[model samples]
Target: MRKLVIAISMLALAASAAFADPILDRQALMKERGKIVGGISKVVKDEEPFDAAAVLTQLQALQANAEKFDADALFPSGSDTGDTTAAPKIWEDMAGFKAVEDKYLADIKAATAAAPADVDTLKTQFGAIASNCGTCHQTYRVKKG
Candidate 1:
């Protein structure tokens, strides 16, 4: 009976610990997205002329990463466990969330494609993408403690 009691206590403690924090795979995804987007934004705004080929390569790579961030992953189909910065409205209004992602992706693609052509044009398009980040964050993310 004593062995049984100790086993039950251990299981209870383990379960409590596991439930204490929210687990999220989206954090890594967001971090990578920020790095790629931020890099491109900085490069475009500064109008630095490295080798044209190198600039184009970096722009393309950033575009590819932006394209890969699945909308579903941004707002999981399952329980969020309160871990995601994505607002509850994201899940409740799936279409709206997808539309934001679509706009964001389109902005990145256009900006990247244009970067090699004219730095001025790239800056304009990239600015549009950056604006989306602020817009989404304003509406969606809950302020962290």
Candidate 2:
């Protein structure tokens, strides 16, 4: 009976660890970002000189996706991963991580809000958001070894 209990406890712990993986969450976030980008591109291509009204609605949808990409939530308490694209240092350097996250979120928020006036404006705003991806990738993302 004691052996069975130990085995059950170990299984529970392993399941919890699987549920707590940050790498899976990061992958999900990347997938979501791709979906949002696809949606935005579809809108852009369809709306030539750019239908401000339709594009604005699409931008709003993009913002909804952004809400899911919050760094705080991405790196939730107790979440860790051995194979994350995110560096382990992020956990130790909370202030630096938050600063970069704040910059990313703020920039994306503004861009989403400003994206719909015209095609040129949408391009500028989208570029602003893309720049953050590059910035964060350069600083925080670990290349696969």
Candidate 3:
């Protein structure tokens, strides 16, 4: 009986780990996006001198990541647990959530194509991109304590 209990416990642990993987992957992806955004923002805010090439590279990366940010795969039904800041509403209103994601991705792609050549251009483009990001976060993400 004790051995059976141990086996059950192990199975539960493995199940939890498997469930946690998508959450971890989503968090890591978001962090990467944040870092790229921050880097671009610094130049836009004059906190860093403008580097057109670097900004372009970061924008390209943002577009690539946004393209790969598959909400369906990342936010599976049981993914709300374990380090995830995704609100339950994501799964509840899956269509709305996906629309927001699609909009954000579209905005990112537009910004990438624009390839801001100067600080002023970057400021305008980044503002639109950031606004789209905030919109999704406001509706879909839960603030973590």
Candidate 4:
């Protein structure tokens, strides 16, 4: 278990290394996070087979995704413009931004610690973490087109 977490951490860091441009890096991270959620959603929806290990890995990877943010670097000064959908409110209320982010990480950690081995339990835990995504997006993202 420790090895898996360490490996996921290394993969997360290595992936982040590709994004020298903070905007691009942040964007990529968001997409990766979404993809992680989507994979879990598939299992929840029965669109894919549920292996408990796979589900747990998904949650761990999500936690790693959350940890990748160096908020200030990801949302640096004057980054509220250009080819991005970050809401101005991020810069306007960064404390609130970080709080929401912290909440997200905490929820992911809680779900992971639960190590939900059954689909029903996974459903409950998954809902909590998934809701955080919707809540944050509403507050921090600008709808594009």
> For model 3, which pairs clash?
none
TM-score of each: 0.69, 0.66, 0.83, 0.84
Q: List per-prediction Cα lDDT, in the order shown.
A: 0.70, 0.71, 0.86, 0.89
| Residue pairs in candidate 4 whose N, alpha carbon or C atoms collide under 3 angstroms | none
Root-mean-square deviation per candidate: 6.8, 5.2, 5.4, 9.4
lDDT of 3 by residue, 5-63 (tens): 99999999998887558887788889999998998888988999998888889999998
What is the TM-score ranking, best to worst? 4, 3, 1, 2
Considering lDDT, which of the candidate structures 2 and 3 is the better prediction for this target?
Answer: 3
User: For candidate 1, lDDT tens digit of each residue in 1-145?
Assistant: 9999999999999988754332344576677778777666666768455445666776687677777667664455664555666677767877877788788888877766666566666667667988888877877666677
Report the Cα lDDT for residue 1, model 3. Answer: 100
RMSD of 4: 9.4
Report residue 114 deviation for candidate 4 (angstroms): 1.1
Off by over 4 Å in 4: 1-18
